[model samples]
Target: MDFGPFLLLASLEGLVQAAVLSLTALGLCLTFGVMRVVNVSHGEFYMLGAVIAWWAASILGPKYALSGYLIALFLAPCIVGLLALASERFVLRSLNYEPEATIVATIGILYIIQQTVLMSFGPDAKPVNPPFYFRIDFPWFGYSGYKLFVIGAAIVVLSGTWYVLARTRVGLIMRATQLDRDMAQAFGIPIKRVYAYVFAAGAMYAALAAVLIVPIRQAHYLMGADPLLMSFIVVIIGGLGSVRGAIVAAVLIGMSDGIISMFFSPTLAKMVSTLLVALVLVFRPQGLFGVKTS
Candidate 1:
């Protein structure tokens, strides 16, 4: 077996995975950092995004002679955000300041979403093909143009998020809220509205990541499981609410998964990744960039 080409493909796949993981982790960080809720059901939200995108592309894109793919890309995240708003307003709002209860509620939400999708679309996988197939070949590597596009789009979204959170007034309020909800409320910040916005924004990011991943993994009801695990490991290693930590951990995890899968079995690769996450948590429970929690 030729090692050169194999390594190149693995590198490309790793880059793509890293980008997806980072975007998803960013969403987790935003929610965890701001709401202090351990949302274990975020993976289901990602799956919803992918499935919604696939259905929209199939139903609306072709019949009206429109760009089904583009429509999916735009609409799926919005739908996810709307769902997040509904969930936060109704369920999560009731569980405010109750982290354990919020976590349990999110888990319930996850199963509900999974079963709902299964009932609506059945358990079969759905394919979302790109509009065009073009590869930009280079001396070092060659990969699907669509995959490259996914990476590019993820980068753009992550960068835009960073800009918003770091530069804008809303972002300042978000950060202020994350630092201390009670304090922010005392200082005239609309704490409830901030929570809603953060939840919606994080949901939007998760949905967007799922939409981008469809071309790579296809769509299925249970597709959220693995990514959800990966995202949790990332958030844990990076630290809650630390976007930089998430990115760094995502790259490490992505590269580890990619290189290991190339040489070993998928099952072994996952086992090793889980072990690594455990070790990280044992030593640094707060995560690499996480603030110390009382």
Candidate 2:
């Protein structure tokens, strides 16, 4: 392929990556920003989503591709959300959400989930059949229609999330809680309930991202590490609790990954991203969009 065509294709791939990363990192940011909790197991939830999606594919069969995908699209997030809710209730809540302790607790959860999946699902990567497939033939090249759908879906989900956080009463309460937990509680916001739901919401975001990406990347036991690391990088570069920032950072990182990987290698792309993060940390520790506190 010519350089122009290659670059165009790379950019499209990067946009897709950004879309998925936005959802995953946004979830991480929400948990950290609102609940002040670090969920080391967040990536596990993503892995679980992909695994469940593969199960959905298995049950429904290739003949029912679209149906299977739709079922997994809705079902996986719900299941992951429930698991997140339960973990928040039983583990984080009992530990009082102390930063250091919750970190340790979630790490334990990560290992448990990883090992369980390893034992049950085995170590092989499972490919998922996309719900439907069509190719958009450009003059220079072709692209997957499903990937474009993913980009649109990401836009819709991000917009809805923004509306809820910025416009709705539910959002108002959550923001109030995020801004001032003691005051919100004094005003009758159920702090425990909010944290539980928020945690679940975060996990659901990760799961949703996984569902969207599973067909492309397939399901694997150890796939969570990259998403988890990139999410933390996104959160750091974008500014904690800044939805807009997270989206922007995801695009920046995702696009860079795509373009660099096209010309050189994926590993080099990651190294460049990490270097960007290091520079950001040194120059703006609060993140590109985060607020500085006294």
Candidate 3:
């Protein structure tokens, strides 16, 4: 195959990665942007989604694998989201949403989730069958149809998220809360409830990303680590609270990662990503899309 075709394939692969990363980072950004709480355990929620999907698929796969996988696709995130909502009400709310304290609390949550999954799911990596299988033929190669599905699904979910945030009253309430929690509360915005919803929504996004990618990558208890790191890098480079920035940055980073991994090595790709993040931090502390806060 010519280098041009190779590059094209690499870019497609990158798009898939970027799509998943964008959703994951958006969740992180929403939590921080709106609630000012850095969820250290965010990746665990991603892992939890995959684990739950694996469980759901396993139970249902025996009878109707496709239907089971489809059910898991929707059910896993809801389970993870509800768990997150409960955690926020019980753990974070009790802490009064203090940033530093929430960090510690989420760390505890991270360990708790990881260990629980380890005990229940065991340490082995588990794979889920894709709902359907096909390939897109190219001049020199073919790409995964399922991966394309992931990218398309991400676009749809992201669009729905945008509509919710931009066109709906809930979005208005969340935005108002993000801007000034005290004032929003004074205006009867139910800041505490908003915080709970945002936190759960953030977790739901991460879980959705996990469900989308679990078919490509097997579910493992430790799988959350890299996604967490990549998500943090994306959020930081894109601007901590900017959804547009997160999506843009995810594309840039994901493409670079795919191309670099194809041509060089994944380690090198990660190194380059880390270097890019450092450069962005040094030059643009507020991030590409983040606004300066006083």
Candidate 4:
């Protein structure tokens, strides 16, 4: 294959990665942006989604693979979202939503979820088969049809998220709460309830991303670590609470990761990304889109 075709193929792969990363990071951004909580358990939610997807598929695939896969796609996020809401209500809310305390609480939640999965599902990595098999023939090679679907699905989901946050009453309420919790409360905005919903929504986004990508990548108990790290990187680089920045930064990081991993090494790709994040933090602590606070 020519270098140009090779590059194009790499870029396509990168776009898919960027799509998934954007969704994952957007979740983190939403939670932190609204609740001011650093959810250490966010990645575990991703893992749980994927694992649940695999479980759902396994149970249903024998008789109806396509239907089962579709059902898994729909159910995983809802289940994860509800679980997240419970955590927010019972754990974080009870803690008074303190940033440091919430972080510790989420870390504890992380281990709890991880160990529970380990005990129930064992340590094996499980694979969920794709619902359909087709490829788009490129000049140099064929690309996965399913991957293209993932890219398109992610775009739709992200767009819908934008619409809800930008154009809806609930979004306005969430924004109001984010801007000034005390003032919003004074207006009887039910800030705690908004926090619970935002927290759930964040986890739902993460779960949706996980479901979209789990077929390409097998479900594993330990899979949450990398997504968590990359989400943090994207959030930090894009600026905390900045949805636009997360999307832009996700593309940059995802493309770089794909191209570099294809041409060189995954380790090198990660090293470069980490270095870039460090530089961003050193020079722009508020992040690319983050407003400086007094």
Candidate 5:
């Protein structure tokens, strides 16, 4: 109603978006960071999560909405992760993980996944019921409880990822492999196995994000395109292969969409973000948090 309440509502919406975008972009960034392979099919993994969640919900029935969501929560990521692992072993590994070849193969994978979902599910947007429904009454507006849950869930996941990367032996191995694959192999690290796991983890992250957002946005065969483009924008603006950068950029871009779209239009919001990316490219090609490489 009022500007203050309107702004607050927009910010709240933006937080939900930021939370999901961080997970989506993080997956893409991590794939590039550790494996040095650009997985263009990353968004398709996200779509699969939503699609699978819809399937699980239909089977479980509306009487068991909560149970359906819970099943999808775990099932989507596991299936997506395994699929990613298979793709890595059979497709990427066969390509020798060459950057160019991997890109083309992943593009093909993207189209294949999109068309398959379109054929099987048809060209319709499928909605999944939220696990719980409640409203939080603010001074001037109401907020969805599930949206808050999305934000909290994302934070927990991000923190766990940070802990894994910063404090665990697995993280050490990953960092070592990322730093120098030949050297990591020389020290007896199974680089091939590590790559497989990293790729799977990346897909799992995308799937997790999709499961969270599906209730709010609904699932469609072509839905992956926007997230894929947004992830690329985030990756570019944040600097390629930078985890922290991707998260930070996702927040900035996600929030901007909310505020700007509220005051203006979604198209204008996108234009602003694109302009910001251009400015960043011109002034700081390495990005705000990215380290320069020789």
Candidate 6:
């Protein structure tokens, strides 16, 4: 009954899990806040990003592993974002003013993208090994450098996003559009353009998370589904359209999942997390940091 070591491991695992959730949810928050689209296939972008990393690493050889990672880190998001933009422009735009039709259209896009990926890459898992340096560990808690990197990277990216959103002009426009699309438009903001940019940005965020996580978890076509669900839950728990809420909720969920999965079974851990989300929905439907909408 060595709870000490188990607890330590669980905490680390939870943090990793939370980091992944935050990555995915950030995308959801961005798009949902601006475009009001759920983008169900968002998880597929992670799968695609990871696949891109794997393919690049394999095709380019060890000398190019770092290059491949770098490429995936940049290219994956751009590809997904562009795809989302095209979809929005051609498909979603046509379904304007019809929320239900638009949702269904996005779902169709998700399946099409998923199946197309499967056709191209098959259904097997593909690995993307981290660089050699990541194998080393720090003195404290035997935490691998790679895990630390993931945590640190998540913090830096999220922090940078926070700074930009809080300080930048585009960020202000995005916020304004999120709060009131019509008013923002009335003030000369191009509502359609905002929707396109935010959707692309959201997809890019999701892809970035995908590339980051691929080093830890092998890539597979279906890899994004669980993350997608978990992220939605994180977004729900944190309060919709609140970046601060997403961060807070991500850390909490990460810690909770890590600790619970360590002591109990993973299935039990999932059940507990879902139950927590349900409770939040029932009691504080607005979310921990979500502002109430009139």
Q: What do the candidate models score in CA lDDT, each in turn?
A: 0.85, 0.92, 0.90, 0.92, 0.92, 0.82
Model 5 poorest ten-residue lDDT run: 269-278
Give lDDT tens digits, candidate 2, residues 1-294: 888888899999999999999999999989998899989999999999999999999998999989999999999999999999999999999999999999999999999998999999999999999899999999998899999999999999999999999999999998998899999999999999999999999999999999999999989999898899999899989987777888899989888887788889888878878888989989898898888976
lDDT of 3 by residue, 43-157 (tens): 9999998998788888877567678778887898899989999999999999998888999999999999999999989999999888778988876898889999999999998
> Residue by residue across 163-247, what tens digits does model 5's lDDT show?
9988999989999998889999999999999999999999999999999999999999988888887887898788888888899
Q: Best lDDT goes to which candidate?
A: 2
- The residue pairs in collision within model 3 are none
**Any residue pairs clashing in model 2, and if so which?**
none
TM-score of 4: 0.97
lDDT per residue as tens, model 4, 98-183: 99999999999999999999999889998889888898997679889999999999999989988998999998998999889999
lDDT of 1 by residue, 79-152 (tens): 99999899999999988749889988998999999999999988999987675678988666666898888889
Q: List ranges where model 4 is wrong by over 4 Å.
A: none
Clashes of 5: 0
* Pairs that clash in candidate 1: none
Cand. 3 Cα-lDDT: 0.90
